[model samples]
Target: MSGTLNQILNGHLSLYGDLPPIPIGAYDSGLNKTQRQFRRANKISLLEHLATEGWDHFRRQESVATGLDRYHPTKLPTINPGVLTSKYLLLVIDGTTHRAQSLAVTGGWEHVVSCSLANMNSLPNLLRDYSAEWISICHASDILANGALHALAGHLQQAKTNTVMTCDDIIVRQLWNDGLGYEHRQYRSSVSAIRLCTRGGIGGLLTLDYSLFKQCSFAPSYTCLEALRLDVLLQITREPIKTTHCHQALVKHQGSKNPSMPEQGWPRERCPFSDKQLDEIDRIKSQHAKQYFGIEGGLKPNPLQAGCHDLSRPTDESSLVSILIPFRDQVELTSTCVKSIQQNAGKSCNYEIILIDNGSADNSTIEWIKKAIKEDNIQCIRLDEEFNYSRLNNRARQLCKGDFLLFLNNDIEFVSESILDVLLDPFAHPKTVAVGSRLNYPDGSIQHQGVVIIPGERRCVLEPGKHLKEQEVIA
Candidate 1:
C-alpha cells in the first residue's frame, strides 16, 4: 500500500509538473488507469489507519468486572437519534445597519437588537413561537436574493445536526466613483476564497444547528464583532465539524469602499475600533497561523511585487509578440503610444507594432504612417470603412504572426519597462485564457481594475470609486 501510494504521488508530480500535491481521495473524472489506481490506494490506506486507531483505543479501555460480561465482547457507544434533529436559532449580527434592514425585507425573518453577547442568549427564548431547527448568523450588509432564505431553511432542516452550511457570496459593488452614479458589478466568490474563509471558521455567513451554538457561545471579551466571530470559529475548529457548501450565489455582499477594512477605517457613521482592540485581533490571527499552518511569521500581505528580470538579455526573435492598435487618424496620440511601447517594452522583447488605419482622412497622417513602415518594423493595414472595434481587431489578428497577441488602443501609453513581460508571464499556466492590466485615468484615478457583469445586463461595468489592488479576478 505504501509503495502504491508513493507511485501515485510520483506519477501525479510527473504528470502535472512541479505543482501542489494531489489531495488524498481526489481523482479526476477523466483520469487514466494509473491515476485511478493511485486514488483507490490512498482511500484504502486512510480507512485502514482509522480502523487501527479504533482498535487500539478499544483495547486500552478496561473491561467491566462482571461474571456475565466475562465472555461477551465489549459494546461500542451508540449515537442518540434525537441529537440529529435538534432545532436551530438564526442569529443575524448587525454589522451595517442597512444589511439587517435588507435581510428583513427579503427574508421576512424576526430581528432583535443585541448590544452584548448576553443579549443574544435571550434571543432563542424570544423566538420560541417560531419552530426553527437551525440558526443562521449573517451580517447586515449581506443581502439574500429572493428565495435564498427559504432554500437555506430547507437545507438546514434536512441536514444532519453536526453539519454546518454556508452559501457562496456574490460580491456586488453598489457605489461607483463616490456617488457619481450607481451600478451593479457582481462576481461570484471563487472556490479558493470560500475554502480558506470557511475552513478557518471565519466565514461571514453561516447556518448551523442550535445545539452547536449551545456548546460554543460567543465571547464577550472582544468588543469588535470581527474578533468575536474569529473566536467563535476557533472554538468550532476544536471539534470535527462537517461543513456543507451550498454552491449557489444566494447572498450579495455590499462591497467595501475602502481599499481594505480598518486600515482606511470603516465608514464615518460606523463605530471605530480602538488601537487596543486592533492589537488583540492581530494577536489572534498570528496565533491561528502558527497553530494551523506552522508559520512563525505572519501571513504575507497582498499586491505582492513582481520579481525582477534582466532587461539586458538578448531578444528571442522567434518568440514574436504582435501588438495590434486600431486608429482613425489621431496620428500624434498614436505616435506617442507606439514610441512609449518601443522604449519601455525593452529591446529584449521581440515585438512588431501593427497599425490598423480605419479610414484616416489626414494626408499628413497617412504619409507619416508610410514613412514609419519603411523606417520602423511597423505593419500597416488600411480599411476604408468606419471604425468598428471588434471587426478591426479580428482583421488585424488574422494577419499577425506572433504566438502571443496583445490588442491595444492607439491612445494607450506604456507605464513600466517590464510591462510586456509582466503581462505575458501568467500565460505559462495552461488554464489562463486571458489577462488584463489595471487601467488608470490621466489624473491617476482608477478607470478599471476589472470588468464585472451585472445580473440581467448585457454590458459589463467596473466598480465605481473603488480602486482594487492587484489580484486574480473573474472577468
Candidate 2:
C-alpha cells in the first residue's frame, strides 16, 4: 500500500537533484487514491455525494471528496460577475488567522473579486517557483497544528504575479493586496501600498478602506490576487492560534499536485473583524485589562534602561548563568538531557536551570522537577495549552535572572561548561545577538556548531556538521 505512494512521489526525485526526495504523498491516500481502487472505482465518488448533503468535516479542509472514493466529482458552480449580480461566490476560511489573509487595505485599495482559475491550475510554475517557504505554504494546513487559513492568507499576499488570458486578447492582472481568509496579514508591509487600480470597475475603489466598507465585502474565496471584503464588525484574531483538532480529522488535504475540491453552495461570512456582527466586541476589547497596561501605556520600565546589551552587570567572566530549556514531550531524551546538565560542567559557575516545562504532555518530568523544586527556583510555568517555540522561549527569557540568555533544546545536554566561558566571553565583546555553544552527540561527533536556516528546506540546519567540516578540511 505504501509502495504505491512511494513510486508516485519518488518519480519527482528528478526535482531535488542531490537532495533526497521527500514522501509528500505517503499520508495523502484519501486525497488521491485509496486502497479501494482495485475493487470499486466509484467508491470514493459516492462518498462526496453524501458529504455535501450534510457534513461539516470538509468545511475548512478542502479536498475532492470523490478523489479517493472515485465515484463522483465535487459539484462546483461557475458564475461570471458579468453574467449575474446577486449570484456571488463565497469562501470560508478555517477560523485560524494568517496575518496576510486578514489585511484590510485602506488607501488606494481596489479589490478583486475573481480568481485566476486557469492560472491556479498551473500548480508550482504559476508564480515562477520563487520557492517562498512554499514547502510550508503548500501543506500549511497540515504542517501547522492548527488552522491553515492564516498560512493561506500569507501566501496570497506574498504571490507577486497571478495572471491569465482573457477574452478579446485581454490580460487580467489580479490586484488584490488586501483579503480576508482563515489567516490575517497587513498589506502595508511588503508592497508599501497594496491596492488595485480597477478591474472592470465592478469592485470597490482603490482609495477606500475596506474595513469601513458597509456594503461590498471582498470577493473570490481563495486566490493570490483576489480577496472578498465582506463587511463585518469582528476583527480577525492575528495571534497565530491552534485548535486541538488533529490533521486526521480532515477528510482530505489540498496539495500542489493534489488540489482540494471547492465546496459548492457554501458561504464564508464569519471572520474575526470583517465588519463582524458582534455589537459589544469593541466594548469588550476596551474593557480587557492587558491593552491598557503593557499595550497602550508602553513599557513599565523603559526597556532601553534595562538594556539588551548591558555591560555593567557582571564582569567576572564566569558568574551565575541562567540556562532556559524550552521543551514539550520527549521523555527519553529530556531525562538524559536533565541528567547531563546535572552532572557535567567544566567550570563552577553559579547557574540556575530554568526548565520551562513548555506545555509538556509528560507529567513525569514536571513531577520530578517539582520534587526537586523543594530547594531551587523551578518556576513551573504551566502553559495550559500546547507548544509555540518562539512565544515560549520569549516568555522564559523574561523570567531569566542570568546576565545572559542561553536557549537550549531539551534534546541537548551541555558537554562543556568551559564552552560557556567562551560563549559568554564573546557576548562581553558586545555585538553578538546570539552566541551558540559547540554541541555534540555521545559519539564524539559534532551535533551543531551554529544554526542557519537553509532556504527551501524550511527547517534550520546545523551549520557545522560532517559535510560542512569536510569542506573546511579540504580547503
Candidate 3:
C-alpha cells in the first residue's frame, strides 16, 4: 500500500477501533497478471512524478490536451487533472428537492461540488472541470465520521472496475410530543422485504466512478428523483458494473428534517407523472426485484394472517421465542410475570425468558434474578441506569437467539394459554412483521384492543370497545 493509503486505513481503524482484516488485492484479483502489474507500475510512476514535479506543473501539462477531444456537447473548461491526484468528489444531494448543495467550498474540497438532479446532464461538465476520477453521492444532511472520506478514497483507489459502493446510515428520527416536547430516536437501518416492497431498494448514499456516473445520470424530466435514482441503479444491474455495500454506519442521516424545496417546482419544468411513466417505473422495479430477490411479479407475500389457531406446537422445535421483559425494583410483579409465562405458555412452547434489570434497589429482587440465572431458568442482563424502554429492548435484542422476539412489560401477566400460539401463527407467513395482542385491565374490561385515529381529533385513541373481533387492522 502507498503511504497515503496506509495512513487513511490507520485513521479509519482509530475511529472505529478494531476492524476485520481486509484481503490485499481483493479488488484487483480479477485482473490478468499483466494488467495488474502494469497498473501498479503506472501508479508508482505517477506517485513519484507527483512528488518531484509538484501539482501545478502536472495540472498545466494535462490542460494542453483538453480541447483535443469532446465526449459531450455540454463541454466545460477542464481543470489540471493533477489537482484531483488524491481527491474524490463528495456530491451531496438534498433528499427532498433532489438539488445538490454547494458544500465543496465549506468542506475545503477542490473537486467536490453540488448540482440539481434535473441538471444532472451538467454532471459531465462538472466532472470535466474538476477532473475527478470518482464521485460519491449522498444526502446533504448525512453526517460522516472523521475517517469516512479516507475510507472512500482508499476504496476508489483499489477498485479495479466501475463500482458502486453503499453503506448503512444511522437513521435519526425526531418527533414533537404534546407532553414530552421533542423526542429523538436513533436506530440502525434494517432493510426488510416489507420495507423494500413499499419504499424500494436501499435508497440512500452511493459512490461510483465517473464512468458509471455518466451512464446513470438523472433524467431531466423525472419528477421523483428518489424513484429515478433507484431506476438508474437497477438499470446498471444488467451491465457488468460491480455493486458493494459497506456494513458500518459511515453516514448518519438526519431524517427528522425535510430539505427545503425550490420555489419553482422541482426539475425546473414540473412534469406531471403520466400513467405510462408510472407503469414503466413499476415495471423497472418488478424487473429489479425478480433479478435481485428471485421474487416473481415483484410482490411480497401477504403478511396479514387472520383467524385463531388451536394451542398446539409443531413436532419440530423451530419456533423458539425470546421473551424480553424489563424489570426494576418491583420483585413481586417481576416474579408474578415470570410465573404467568411459565404457567400459561407451558413446556410445550419453545421459549426462553430474558429479564433486563434496570437499577433495582431491592436486594431480594436482585438475588432472585441472580438465582434464576444460576438455575438456567432465565437469562438476566444487568443495567445500572435509569429506565429507557427503547435502549433496554435494543440491548436485549442483541442477546436474544430466537426465531421471533417478544417484548413484554414486567407489570403484565399472560392471561390466556393460547396467546403465544395465536401470535406465532401470523408470523408463519413471510410478510407478517409484528403482532400485537389485546390488553385488558384486571376487571376484564378492554384497556386497548387497537388504536384508531380520529380524523379531526389530531390524536390516536386506543379503541377500548371497538375492534373486539379477530380482524386485520392497518398499521
Candidate 4:
C-alpha cells in the first residue's frame, strides 16, 4: 500500500473523523500542494525547461506523443491529449481504456478510479454523463497511505507541466443531499436497504461499498456522469453549511396511513426490494441503457446493473410512475382496481402504487399487498384528510415521474389495450401537457370526455378517457 493512503486516512480520521479539522489551505487535485511536492521531487530542471521554451513549445502535439512508438507494433494509436475544461490547463498523462462499451469524450486530462479493477469495463457511467472536459486512464493498483504524494512525485519526475492553475472548474458533488444514497437503495431489502444505501455518511465518491457503483446514487443533476470522466477530488476551503431540508430517509408510511383508507387498500411497509435488492439491479441497468443509449453499438459504458429487479422482485427505473389511489373503504372495489393495474402494467416503466386510505374499516388491503409482492416499488399512503380527490391527486402528481400519469378509479376496469404508444402520443410534444380520453361505462356509453372542470372548480372530472382520436378532444 502507498504511504499516501495512510497519511490521508489518518489525517482524515484525526482531523475530520475524531480529531479537529486540518487548518490547511485549499486542496484541489490538479494544482494541489501535494502535486507541487511531486513536481519538486521530480524534474527540478522543469523551471529551466519552461524558461527556455515559449507557448508554442507546449501547443505542439509532438510534445505529448510517446517517443517509443516502435515497441508495440500492433498497439492502437494513442492521442496524447491536453484539457482546458477548468481555468487550470489540465493535462492528460494517459488515456482511458478503449473499450467498445466504454465511451471516451473528446478533450481532457482527468483520470477515473474505475480502472482500479482490471476486469471492470471502461470508465464508469457518471464520467460519461459529463463527457468530462479532461481525463485519462492511469490505473492505480496500490492503496498506499502516501499514494497521492507518490503520484505527484511521479508526475514531477516523469512529465513536465504546460500550465498550472489556481484551481479546478467544477467538483464532483458529495454533499448530504446528493443522490449517492438514493442510488444504493437498490442494494437493500428492508431497513438494511436504507442503511447501506444512505449517502450522508459516505461523504465522497469512490469509497462506498458495491452500491457506489450503482447509478441510482448518481444525482439527477449528474446526468452523463461517467466515473472516469470526473476530475480528481478537490480540496476546497472549508466553511460551515446551513442545511435547509432533510428528507424523511425512508418512507415510514405505516402509521401515517390516511384515515379513510379501508383495510384492503395498499401494500404494507416492508423493504424497497422483495427478494433482496440484487434481483432488481441489472434490470434497471438494461432498461435505462436502452432508453438513453438506444440500440447503437458504440457509446459509453452502460451504467451499473445492480439495482434493477426480476419478476419475483421487480424494481422500477424506466421513468418513475406514482399510482395514487384515493378511495374510501370499498374493499371489493379497491381489490378490483389494484388487480387490474397489476395485470395491465407490463414492464415498460417503473410503477409505484401509493394507496391513500381516506378512512377504512379494516387494514387488510395493505397487508395483502405486502404478502403478494414485497416490491419496494409499491407504497400505501394513509391520507389525513377526507376524500378530496383533487388534493390527493395533486399530492401524488408531485411525487410522480411518469411522463404521463394514470388516474384510475376503484371501479373502472381497463378492458382493452391500455395507453401503449398511440393514444397518449401527444405527450411527446412539450406543448401537449394533458390529454383527455373517451371514458365509457361497462356498457359502452360515453361517460366522460375525460375532463370537464367547472368554473372556478378545482377538479377536472373525467368526462372520458376511452377510444377517441386526438381531433375528437379538440372539437
Each prediction's whole-model lDDT (CA): 0.49, 0.31, 0.49, 0.31
RMSD of each: 25.4, 20.6, 23.3, 27.3
Backbone clashes under 3 angstroms, per model:
11, 41, 2, 86
lDDT of 3 by residue, 268-348 (tens): 111233444445455555555556644433433222311101111233366678999998989999989988888887555
- Candidate that beats the other on TM-score, 1 or 2, i.e. the better one: 1
TM-score for each prediction?
Answer: 0.40, 0.30, 0.36, 0.28
lDDT of 4 by residue, 1-475 (tens): 5564443322221122211111011111112344455446765442232222211232231221111111111211223443223211111112234421122132222333233222233334434444322122221211111122222222333222221111101111111333221011111111111111111011111211111223323222211112221211111001111111111111111111101111111111212223322223333333333343222221121121122111111222455556677777777788787777677665555577776666665668655655534656666656768678988888766666565576767776655454332234333222234545556766665566543122222233321133322111100
lDDT of 2: 0.31
For residues 319-418, what per-residue lDDT tens digits would candidate 2 score against the true structure?
6677777767676676677666676643444567677776665678667767645647455455555678777777777777887666778888666555
Best by TM-score: 1
lDDT of prediction 1 = 0.49
How far residue 410's Cα lies from its native spot in candidate 4, in Å, is 1.8
- By summed lDDT, which 10 consecutive residues of candidate 3 come out lowest? 64-73
- Candidate 2: regions farther than 4 A off: 1-318, 346-348, 361-363, 375-377, 441-447, 451-472
Which prediction has more favorable lDDT, 3 or 4? 3
Judged by lDDT relative to the true structure, which candidate is superior, 1 or 4?
1
For residue 317, give model 4's deviation from the true position in Å.
7.7
**10 residues in a row with least lDDT, candidate 1:** 304-313
- Sort order, TM-score high to low: 1, 3, 2, 4
User: On a 0 to 100 scale, what is the lDDT of residue 229 in model 2?
Assistant: 20
Off by over 4 Å in 4: 1-317, 363-373, 397-403, 418-423, 449-475
Alpha-carbon error at 442 in model 3, in Å? Answer: 24
